[model samples]
Target: MKKIQFILSFLLVGLLIACNSDGKNNSASSAAEIVVADKVLQNGTIETMNPDQPTAEAVAMKDGKIVFVGSNNNVKDFVGDNTEVIDLGGKYVTPGFIDAHTHVIASSFTTSGVNVQAAQSIDEMLAIIKEYSDKNPDLKVVQAVSYRPAALGRNPSAADLDKLGLDKPVVALGNSSHDGVFNTVALKLAKIDNNVKDNVPGVVYWERDASGNITGAAIETQWMQTYVDIGAWIPEIMVPETMNYMQGYLASQGVTSVLVPGVITPNFGISSEATRQDFEDIMKILTTRIESGEAKMRINTMPFMKLLDADPDDYVPFAVRMREKYNNDMLRVNSLKMHADGHYNDRAMSMSEPYNKDEGDDLPYLAPLAMSADVIHATIMKATSENINVVLHADGTRVIQTATNSIIASKKAYPEATTRHRMDHISFINPETAAQIMEYNIPLNATPIFTNAVENGKDGEAVLKKYSKETVERTMGLYMEMAQNGANVSLGGDPPGSVVEEAYPVWLFQQAMTLEQPGRPELGAFPQNRKPYTIDDALKSMTVNAAWQLQMEDKIGSIEVGKYADFAVFNKSLRDIKPENLVEEAKCVGTMLYGEYTHNDGM
Candidate 1:
């Protein structure tokens, strides 16, 4: 039905253009030069996100662009006999939400596998895995995603997985998306045993039992390689289908645009080999969707490069080539993403101070930087010199500091460069670092859902048992603080790992405003500061600021004349809802992109 509507909308717009372009109908041309709208939405509360026209009651769209934005009385000029006038009945409308950083291809890989996120304990998880295997008796390796370490009493072990009574390998990806537990059969397939050497030693290695025997749990690069080697990922033949589902799901959440900062490649390590090919495959899928009018949202991707020691010359050109080749309205490549550190769990994040020391643990130490500052600076200089935006994933403060220094140096070296470097996951940035990030005009792409303490009320949670209370209060969520401090901040789910639900714009809005888990105010907003984002700023993060991050501020971020007719309609005004009731009261009912409804429940 959506496809049919999209096709009809395009055909109708094309017919209008054809009829108007030739000026063959003198009678129509001379009749007051009236401009006809393809569609007019009136009698609704609309937030344009445009400073000039902050609020409106109606809008008119033509040729996939907003032709009129004003009150209902003024919109009649564009309403013709043929225009599809939708009486909004006082519903609320805003610029379609833009997720500054998200994963489509990477999320597709995870969704192709079994999902065990709903299981609260090991026994229940085992039941799910057994049930999945039973349903697909001929499946090769069983791979499950969203395994919650907190919900389960402890990480499932290979020995525990033996109870499934299957000879096949089973791997459960941790919710962090950085680690996984491999059953013994998987270990045997990967030849990982007592003598298997660790990758990068402590930072990326397998868990071990007494006497140094491999315990089947792996972190960082090893588990990723294991999953790849055992063919646990989705087959290449199914990628297109998976990508479509992910795209449609995001559209249902009111998202019209997304910036996929990084996607996990097949090689799965800190190097640039095969990354371009991986991106090419993803682009092929998106290209097909756009050609067939099956694309629900516009995508801008940044090819991920994990340059540990490789020269910038090896990888920066690939990003440039991608930009030169795929510069279109629907899909484009503009940045090169790099990883600077790992997640904070297991003491992998490079922090200024060691995590809270636990008994029977190895001596506390800061995790070594994945890429030294010099290498990072050189990479940024080269990439920025080529006019490519460099997005650094820096979670820990120390890594954020390093990335900031590099960005500052790059900015100084090329002061006139128009590129916008991003600090992804600004998960734990201190005051000084935050100031530098704000001062340099660096953009921060934040994932608010991961900061909820109540939802993560399990063992190994970042704020609990790892960092000190003072640290949590001072540096944890500077989302609003940075925005208040003149930083360009945008919100995203960083999904498939950071977020369980894809359609969560309302949820993200709630988390950004209240900083508390949904329906669980008892958790008391984890950061301890309890600082909430202002309503306007929170809405901007989802709209205008996010459009700036995409480098499409002039095109589709807001509802304005000459801009794309993209909007998200909600059942109620987000402004009227209390911060705590946002999740319960507000919901996205329709998402329109380029004057076509991609998702419409009832609008």
Candidate 2:
């Protein structure tokens, strides 16, 4: 258990505003000089990923793009006379949803903590840390963050430290980096007694009794971090007034593009270490919180290559000093992430075979969590020859065939960064090796369960430990049977990793067709591959194949003519709703993004 070395930290994010096409906020770091307007709204319904399949209604916008989508009297010569019209009372629109992968400061630093995600036991998560330690009794402790000891089948002892008998100190978070839950007076202010043993590497150690002790569980088995030199709830979100309640919780979940997998390294282990907030302290706290307007969504990020004592040619001068110092497309960096394996209940997922909960097939595998698989395939063939963007995180099936054979041997030993290499949390690969993913159609991103599906009242053979229930119904619709034998899927939710926001695509499209949950009706999500995805193939795996897996599908997934008006007005009709009121009729009351009005949703 000695391989937690994956230290590759570097941070710098400064300028980068760009979003014009009318959604405003364009610091014009690049791409601009576009102006074309005339008789717009010529037509609508244009989610055109065009392999032929169209007609949502008709779309057309002006100067800000999408001047015509077809037939509302075709773009009246780009609709001038200061063109501006409205007519979607015919509702139903698409083309604004592309969350390929997540974590983005673990779902935007969960709007700075203490939300025990609707607490479900541990006495409703110690009554949300006893009402935030009875409302700041001298602040000193209490940490909430992210929690889930397999959604409470247990883990959080020193007798769940008698609910802070006020020795003041409690910590929680384990929507898995493979478990965490301090309490023992924060394990004696992190002194962690009795042969402390945490040879670290993402983390894992439930191992109990016979005197080897340590049964308050714990996990990392590959990426288990838990530190607290104590910034200690940094006064419940170091307020400039907690950044407008985390930008009104991402404009009430319309979430106009965000990535932030994690960074601000140094003690990049989830908490403390010479405390560095890395990435140049997240570009001096997001370009000084976007000049005090406290910037709301659109921020992109992917820093975390930490392989312990660093230096493997520090990731192309740390992603060319974060894209020549905070490029654009909203604070860009292009990707590096890497983890290769961990989670799926920390049997450390590198499994090709053997976890029938370990017995017989000689019980082994687990531990590709970080390091030596030829040093994680020579750091994904050295960040695919430094064009950066590698991503990794493969949850089992021989770490998705050693991450699809180290990204087809790092794009055939570097044929110039072929530009796509993701793989993250790919829950259960191997349906006859998914016809080797058409070699590398360059985009294989998979999240649909919007990343975690957290109403997890637990069951899927009690949350995966070596799986069952016929291996979670034969790996639940492996993303709509590999996007109906086409692949290239993307869509994200991750938020607090599972609480697929108010209407999570209708309880995860009925748990991807009955993998089960939502008035139980007898459990299914994939009862023997139930496979049923059509709401136009789950709205083209969440809009034009998740905006062509972030190549940004010709300016934000189709609304078309010129594109980028970012939408979602839904009052109903995702083809006449009802997969039982399509989770209260697909909500989004209003959510424009590029056309502004960033989310009204009636809240």
Candidate 3:
């Protein structure tokens, strides 16, 4: 009996051992099944921008999406033999920057041509143009961009450009990009002579001398014709190369995405068959680049609404077709762009009151509205009904009110729709308008760089003289009021049209944080009522908030799991830098998109 009990005990022990071994094997298999990341960035201060987990020490990316954002100790599970591990060495990493509103094609044209952004005098600008023309003698058209008359003390006439002695046609685009001065040769080439009638009423016009001769200057819609003509002269191969270079340049500046607010259209003085064909060709080239992995940054474009002679109804189908054709992760075309008013400099922006008249100007100067409220309301309703977005370029208080009223009407009509319509360049706003913007949840794309120019640059004196001191002080930007009211306010540089200096996200952040111009730091604009944004607030404007404006918050805006591994690494931590040095000292070390370096500085 004793022998039998011992054998039974041994058999039971053997069964228990087998059960324990099976449990161990299953645990090991589960550990082995964990997927490894394609790339792991460790030992960095990651500013996740994810409200739930705002900071992390490590980030792991797999298949272009972030797989893990946590402590270094916990990231080992994602590491594998083939994974590229980058030791950040405690560098600061934040979500890639988003330029909410920019004219990429226009900016690229200027960047690739004679950039006269720093020309302080007309002579300097002419000299630069002459030099560029002489250097590129084979070119058919010589173009110079960012021609600010305020900086030159007066606007230049065609005669000024004629003195350059360039054999090729010369065109000098205004800082606004909606106006331009062309030499006699350029005018003749573009067929803009004294007999050219205003094609688009109240929108397109050519300035004339007292002698009834063409002044060589064109404004608004008329400028489009000049551009189209000049673009037609550019070599076909140069277009894509220039665009590719500009994309890489933007990535170097930490921009991963951009919203091109307007594309060339056949309307607005581009009615010629050749110009229209050129526009289509340029767009096709851009599309090919985006599809073939040449475009480094994601682009979201808004088609110009007033294309050719087509009315609002005619635009719906075209916009829908574009949306269907280019709606994807890298490119989107769901928005239609409209002009609500003109610029403040031209005294054409619709305001509540007349501008301060200059000496001998008897009549009060009230800017013209680009579109009436009724027209905007109808257009917005049409766009919203189709679930399409509309972005209106509204700068003045009256225009802002018009746009706000239109948005409110659209929301009332389509309460269940998710139309994220936006208003660009809300340069002037009051507390009442701010409240309305918040109430409707309309995105406010603020170009504070333009405000900076109005308050401190060459335009400051003119702006102060044109409007009442109270109006100038209280209504410029109103960024603080907009933010405090819980409005979705995002920053845009509006480059090429507003000088490249304004496009720098760091400079923009500095302006938002200080409200003080870099050139004039004595007093902040709107000192009494204006409050500066915190660094965090300013960062949000360029990152997630701007992404939200593009309707891409879930993908590229922040560092979080299941989001694209797009980040901009700075040489120094943004939090460690002094607020005043934010613009001058904050340097971008590298920019990454989809776990791969788009722009790197040897680190």
Measured by TM-score, the strongest candidate is: 1
> Which should have the higher lDDT, number 1 or number 2?
1
Better of 2 and 3 by lDDT: 3
- How many residue pairs clash (N, CA or C atoms closer than 3 angstroms) in each of the candidate models, in the order given? 0, 53, 1
Query: All candidates' lDDT scores?
Result: 0.77, 0.54, 0.73
lDDT agreement of model 2 with the native: 0.54
406: Cα error in model 1, Å: 0.8
Candidate 3 residue pairs in backbone clash: 267-308
How do the candidates rank by TM-score, highest first?
Answer: 1, 3, 2
lDDT of 2 by residue, 1-603 (tens): 233332221111111112222222221122232224532332334445444335534555544455445445433433446655655665555655555554444233323447565555678787787788888777666666556554555555556645568786666656532445666666666666667665553333544445766655556521233343434434224433333554445445444565555452324544322222355665667667666654655566666654454334665457667767776654667666666556655565565654555443444544555444666677677777777666666656677777677778778888866467767557777665556755566456554442233423344534555555554555534655777667876545554455334324445554454444445444334234446566666667656776655556677765654566666666555677656456555665656655655667541
Rank all candidate structures by their lDDT, best first, as comma-separated numbers.
1, 3, 2
Q: Against the correct fold, how does model 3 do in TM-score?
A: 0.86
Q: How displaced is residue 356 in candidate 2, in Å? A: 16
lDDT of 3 by residue, 1-603 (tens): 999999998888765444322322211123333469899988999887777677888888899988777777667777999999999998999998898887765345544467786677889998888888888889877788777655676557899999988767777877767677888887777777778886444445676666778688776656666766755334454455446665676788788888887654423346433433444456676788766877787888766754235356866666777788778877788888887776665566778767898655678877656666676787899999998888998888888888888898889989997889998888788668778778778888887656665333543665666688788777876866677556788887776566555566777777777666555554345334467778788788878888888888889788877788898998888888777778778888888888778899955
User: Candidate 1: lDDT of 452?
Assistant: 62
